[model samples]
Target: MDLILDFFLVSGIVIIAIILLQLFKVKHKELPQKVLIVLFLLLFFVAIHFYALLHNIIWLIHLCFLPNDITTTILGPLLFLYVKTLFLKEDGLVKNTLGHFIPAFLFALGITIPTMLFNIFKIDTLAYTHTNFIRTIIRFESLYFTLYLFISLQLLSRYRKLSKQKYSNLTQYDFNWIKIMFLSALFIMSIDIGIKLYESFWGDLSWNADYISVLCMIVLVSFLGYYGVNQSKVLLPSFLLNKEKALNIEKTKDKTLSPNKKEEFETLKHKLEQVLHTDRPYLDEDLTLGKLAQQVSTKDKILSTLLNQYLNTTFYDLINKYRVDAVKEKINLDSYKNYSLFGIACECGFKSRTSFNRIFKKHTGFSPSEFKNNTL
Candidate 1:
């Protein structure tokens, strides 16, 4: 058990070190960097909590004893915000959404004020006058974190469905890693809740339980690092909103296309295809609905509506379709016979090999290598 605890402590330090390197060593500070900083700070507190639990070092225990265990309070909001940053256009915190951190702030104040008066200032004889109150808050905070975990899952599910509706291939903007992390988090939190229940009902717990919690935390950190580092950026044009607000948008958009405008829409759809073929805008790789609209001298909303209603596809899908066709043409060209399949894909405006391969397989029945071999 001692060995396990020691290993877990070392693992926490290693994870923290890796996070620090990522934060400072990277040249550009992007959304992912900002997300990592949040994760790092969260784990830093957890590590301190673990050290305090071990009680080997007197000063460490003193430092942690009165400090608010606000880890749970902040973790949920941070994670949910991280997911928001990944997919939403306005990734930063908004005025209305700032209330999410209110509970965390309240917890910090609740813990610190009483502890300062009782422990540090010695104004009260008791070391912790609000022991029962603090314990109750901690219990409720566990449940609160669980609620946020569910909220995060819902947000991810919503975004994923919306992504499919907006994009043909998910490889470029997939958040599968984040999904895995959230599920792992749910499992970890369940274990924590169970332990907390045991402590509440079954009296004192063994050191082994502490060891297990620390080990689980270590696993959580590993998940964060692995997923957070490799995640690709996602560009969602829609405004970020809460679940209720997002549902309202869906309801409003449910109104079908007017029959009177169907003929004009078909004409515009035909024009869209002609423009796409002649301009070959998909070859630019960064082609977006607005950019394509500008190229075709069309309004963004008009193009969005045309793609969604008339073509039964998204701008992303329609663009990728053209890109796939272009790649097929390039692959068959005599001048490109010597080019590697990936090179051809890149030339055809596919940025990621994973995306290219996945989308190619989706469009064609065979893989790139299979197609190349069959041609031979």
Candidate 2:
């Protein structure tokens, strides 16, 4: 009991310390900080309950009296919330936020209420082995395991989707913390299950090993809190054109490289413009600066410089100008009005209705429909 108390205290302090720090880590928050906060609080709850059990605290002793089972119950909900928060904040999937826990919570109630009633019904057997509670916890712990595996799978899917997203100036912020968290959950659940299994088959012998699991969990929570509290710099990826406008100084390199830099840049710009003119490659779905640079035998850095300084526009803005011109020409022809603005956008060069409207409005000071009504 003393050993268990020590385990709970160490882990408990770590848990609470982290949470307090996270509350201080305000201003420019992200998924990582939120995750860390939740983790710290959850561990604190688990550790406190266990510490109470070790001391046979009366209110706790009367209220269910099973430290391990109570902790087990809380774990499932905490983890469910963790995963749900992750999917909601990171992906903006609002529908998925609270819905994922209904099935798990319902199934847990099946195990929890039944196990409690059954224990009351069988005090004789419980007294002999001191592990009737352990047997009961197994069923719910299995549910927790399945929930965790589901969360891991979902995270992997999100990782793949994020990899494919365009113009994500977001950086990977400490996925290592998440990996450690998942592994810590696995280890604790394993110990809980292992203890129950051994007590059921071989009889309750020792409680020494549980301390190791608690310490591991505490360390995990403490680390998560540290990561939460630590200051992470944001890249603040403002649009390049906006940034250039604000800075206002000439963007060209100092002590200009003779005529060489300008000449090289002009050649590359002309080559890309030629392709842009021919294939109307600006219309292609994946026509990024890197892809365009490859075709034109130039670096994106050099092309960007030339486009901004000489053409007086960003590559995105420059590409959209052609699209706008195409749309205007089509609208000028009475035959084109038969189709809608969405149709006209596709005919011009846009990939989606939203992208078309965004770029069109930026270029032409009106929505596609508004521009068409005024001009066409």
Candidate 3:
């Protein structure tokens, strides 16, 4: 048991060090900046948690600085915001999002005010944890953690739905690993709740369950660190590009298309199709609406509008339609006849067999192998 505690403590410090190193050295700006903030907060929280469990060390730190449990209040908001910032185009700390961090602010105040008074009067902090105020704060933090975790799950679900609606190659953006991380959090929370309830009813268990919880948290933080560092940066959906412009265009479309504007739209449509045919950008699995717009020499809004309003499809469908056609064309050729269906899919810019099979079937109303066999 002591060995397990030592393992968690060592692991927590090591992970925090690695996270700090990555934050300083990595220079790419493809992902949102807020992601690093969330990762840092999570790693810091876990490290502090394990630090507090070590005997003598915890007392020394507590004696110097007030013990804080604000990390509990902040973790949920950080996770929810991380998902939002990753998927959305705008920076996450807009006025609308200010409310998300209110709990953290409140918890910090709860801790700081009391600790300041204690320090001012030179009062001992030994019995602070037993106070009703502290107990109430702890309860609220636990309740809020559960609530915020569910909200994070909802954010992930919403991101998934939007991604499927707008992007073809979801391998990078799916964030399935995040779902696993959330479930792990919930598991830890359940164990924590159970431990608290047992302590309340019976008494403290002989084995220190809080240490076990901290160990679980260290593992969870390790997973969070791994995923945060490796996860691919997200591309904003095309429809979300210049949202004000989209809204204005949507409102006016109900009235009429002016002659010049209609002509421009036609030109844009021709250019879009020409680029799709000539350049074959869909063969690049990481192709995005913005990238396609650049290739076609059109604005993202105009290109997305062309696909959404004119063609009545999404960027995902339009691109995957091309990919599906490319695969069909390849499968029909004598050169690809001996190749595996998955190999043909990979050659045709399908990132995974699952996405390829799904998209291919959606477009042609038949699986790749079925289509090939029927044609043969």
> 1-376 in candidate 2: lDDT tens per residue?
5775676576566658657665656776665456556545555655765566577674653344343444544555555555444423355533455565565465445544445545556545334333555355454565566466557746644442332221211223324465666667676667766765776687766664555666676766666566546534222112332434323426554434357776776777678778878877656644565566677777655655566565555565676788788887887687875888878777776667767787788888898889877974
On residues 287-313, what C-alpha lDDT tens digit does candidate 3 reach at each position? 877788888887776777776655556
Ranking by lDDT: 1, 3, 2
How many residue pairs clash in each candidate at the backbone level?
0, 0, 0
Per-model TM-score on C-alpha atoms: 0.79, 0.47, 0.74
Candidates in order: C-alpha RMSD to true structure:
4.2, 19.2, 4.8
Better of 2 and 3 by TM-score: 3
Worst 10 residues of 3 by lDDT: 245-254
Please list the C-alpha lDDT of all candidates, in the order they appear.
0.72, 0.58, 0.71
Deviation from native of the Cα of residue 15 in model 1, angstroms: 3.2
Candidate 2 overall Cα lDDT vs. reference?
0.58
lDDT of 1 by residue, 248-301 (tens): 333233365566677777777787778888987778876666777787677766
lDDT of 1 at 83: 83
**At residue 282, what lDDT does model 2 achieve?**
59
Better of 1 and 2 by lDDT: 1
True-vs-predicted CA distance for residue 340, candidate 2, Å: 57
